[model samples]
Target chain A: MGTVSTVLSPPALRTGMALAGAGFRRWATYRQAMLAGAFTNTVFGFLRTSVMLAVAAGAGGVAAGYRGPQLATYVWVGQGLLAVVQLWGWTELSDRVRTGDVQSDLLRPVHPVLSYLAADLGRAAFALCSRFVLPMVVGLIAFDLYLPHRPATYPLFLLSMLFATVVSFGVRYLVNLTAFWLLDIRGVIMAWLLCSNALTGMYFPIAFLPGWAQAVLWYATPFPSILQAPVDVVVERGTAGHQATVLAVQGCWAAVMLAAAVVVQRRAERRLVVQGG
Target chain B: MADRPTTAAAYRALLGAQLRAQTQYRFSFALDTAASALITLLDVVSVLVLFRVTPALAGFSFTDSLLIAGLANAAFQLCDMCVGNIDTMREYIRTGRFDAVLLRPLRVLPQLVFGDFSPRRIGRAAQALVVLVVALSLADVTWTPARTVLVVIAPLSGAVIFGAVFVAGSTTAFWFVESGEFANAFTYGGRDFTIYPVGIYPGWFRAVFAYSLGFAFVAYFPGLALLGRPDPLGTPGFLPWCSPLVAVLAATAAALVWRVGVRHYRSTGS
Candidate 1:
């Protein structure tokens, strides 16, 4: 076992790179599913854009500081980010735990959580190139989307996206760990997804929510860091300093959630040992 | 030497068995039901959030829009409860369960429908019903006996229309074993589309859903009739009353497609 640990103990960066690459390749093979996802995202993007535009029209061409073009950009970019962040329907870890396949995962030298995170990063990388770009291109053709002129916006948005991905993975990892306690984690996952989608600004801008609700979402949950911050950065909704602050908040949430996941996994591992898994 | 049960009896038997099996896991069933209800709540909240940003959408006041949304939600949930099993057709086909279904004594479609009856889904249906009731109270409709009857039957018509879409979507699984996601573009997408006033969409967009797909008859036209409001887009006077006929027609066409699909499956065995 000592020798095996030594053999498997590569630098964390190297392991993450390899896992991410594998994750990218694995999802790349599902060409049809990717195409279908892209199509659906674009269609929903159009629908959301239309609804937001109507809202703008009703508010005399601007609602909640969003013009027609800005709203379009917001909706389209939100669609692109949906696949990247992927706040729902991710049950791989729970399924493995339920089926006892996680035993093999535990045996590997790499920490299971890190490996899964790496793979998710890889999936997000692929999704950014394919799923993300597809909706953006469709939006560009179909609507006059807002484009950030500042060179800084692109790098900041990328940073925000990366942080959002980490935050999302952290939440999903913690949710999946519930499988250790519950035989069926589907209901828990579904409930988390419903709440996450609402709070993450996936359905609508979190700002549009009531002021008290917005305060609770911003201060009480890590949801906005998952989608709203990144989209805000891209749309240049605020000044550079405000964008920097959003990115920092996203980073903090990502770190906190990742730490929480590690603590939960430790507890879950102890539970598994006691339960004779 | 016992007499065979009628189709209705067979359906009830299958549904009862399914409900019994689900009820065996009472805790899990309750949890799932609550989760489904929460999802419906979030969906309605999303619509309400949009209304919060604006006083009206597409010439409809917040209350009127909520009524449309509530009706659409109730209709979609009812169809989802009945025909949502279509989502699993791909897996059945892949695992050869489709063959088992085919060999059942009952008609294949009814068997498929009954085999996947989920009592837990009523949670979302009940949530949508609350929304409908709230919308009815808020809106200034005449609430005549005939209008009330139309309102009651509207969701039933929606179920038939959406159930037909689900059937058509499931039929495609006979050819493409991984067609669930593709089918979602229609079943789920159509539901999302109808929850809002159709006038918000562009001309071509409205034309496809309203004319080609006949989605306008599902809620928008009926909503207009119930509210005693004229269609801003100038739909014919008879269009609103045509929802039931449209639903029946769509279901019939879907049944035909399903028959063809079953024949294809029998020949290919895939």
Candidate 2:
């Protein structure tokens, strides 16, 4: 236990990096699966782009703040980020908790939340390189996409993506932690998956939603930061100052969600201890 | 041989057992039903948002598009209720549990279909039915007796078409255990593709889905016939009635593929 404290204090950074590297290597081994996934994403990208472009064309080249080319960019970029943020179909942590394997994870020296977050970052890193870049390249060839010329826009977009990954990981961790109380969290997770996919601007732009719904989503959920903010920065929808503001808000949400995850994990661990797990 | 039950009786018994097993977890089943229904609602809402922004899709009015989406949803859900379990065929094949299925007295495909008979999926079907009713009320088409019959039979034919796709996809598991995701591009992706008027898509896309995949026969052609609208892309006037034939042909092809796959599995023992 004394070694656990020492390991937590100074060398935690090293452990985190090692875990991330391991995660990257683990996912990279599924080369065939990755290619198939990339292909599927690209196919769906064309479907979505067709729909959006059709709507815009029907409306005489503008609908809900999007022109034909802008809508295409939104669709393809959203498809790319979908794999990067991984908004659904992850059940590893909750499955572990249900089967009592989470106890082993708790017994490890490192904090479980930090370990999962690090691993998720590595997965996100890999997805960005493979899944993310593939769709964007296809989009570039298939359609006219918006590219921001401002130098600051590129760095800010990257920062927004990093924050988006963090926010997504935090929300997923919190959802999985509900297993401490509910024996079967699958239903809850399913409901969450449906909501997040719609609300996270993956299915369509958040602005296309009704005004009241958009306002509620903007203020109440951290979903838009996951996809919309970064894509908006890349597309240069708003001014540079506005882009900075979006990044700042995204960063803040990520920090707050990560903090909430830590607090929830602590409470869950105490409950587990009380129950003699 | 004298004690053997009829095939119909065997199927009924299998479905009865499945219902009993499913009802044993009543609370979880209810939750899952609601969740499935809610997920289906998202697609409707997405379509609604699109229509809210634009008056028409390609040339179809909002109500017309709604009718297309609703009929497509109803058809897909009906097929999904009966055959969606094919999505898990790979797991059974991988664990060698499929051999037990093959050894049973009943036919393998019927048993597989009945084995996963889920009452919970009725929730999605029910929602689609409601959408269909709403679309029928809103769309300006005159509902003649012939048109009404077409509307009623459309979903059934659509179910057969989608079921054929599911069977074909699952049969691939015998050759490639990890083909589930690839199969999804056909079954699930096909459903997504049919929700819109096929004419709005690019030329190549329309060609593939309409001619190659036969998805056009699923909803688009039938929808035009029911609505009394001509095909904007100049398809034949008689094409709408070809949906049933296309569905039967697809199912026949799927049955042949399943036979080949089963033969291969027996020879390779994998």
**Best by DockQ, which number?**
1
After superposition, the stretches of candidate 1 with alpha carbons farther than 4 Å from their true spots are A1-10, A273-277, B1-3, B6-28, B266-270
Q: State residue A261's C-alpha deviation in candidate 2, in Å.
A: 1.9
DockQ of each: 0.61, 0.53
Q: List the residue pairs that clash in candidate 2.
A: none
Off by over 4 Å in 2: A1-10, A271-277, B1-30, B94-100, B103-106, B266-270
Report how far residue A206 has shifted in candidate 1, in Å: 0.3
> Per-model C-alpha lDDT, please?
0.83, 0.82
Query: Model 1: how many Å of interface RMSD?
Result: 1.8
After TM-score superposition, the amount by which residue A81's alpha carbon in candidate 1 deviates from its true location, in angstroms, is 1.7
Query: Over the stretch B172-208, how does candidate 1's per-residue lDDT look in tens digits?
Result: 7788764536777777778878888999998887788
Best by lDDT: 1
A1-277, model 1: which lDDT tens digit per residue?
A: 4734643566767887999999999888878778878887887887788888999999888777777888889899998998898876798988888787778888897778788999999999999999999989999998988899899898888989999999999999998998888757756777787777778988888878778987788667899989888988888876888888888888899999988987898888876732233
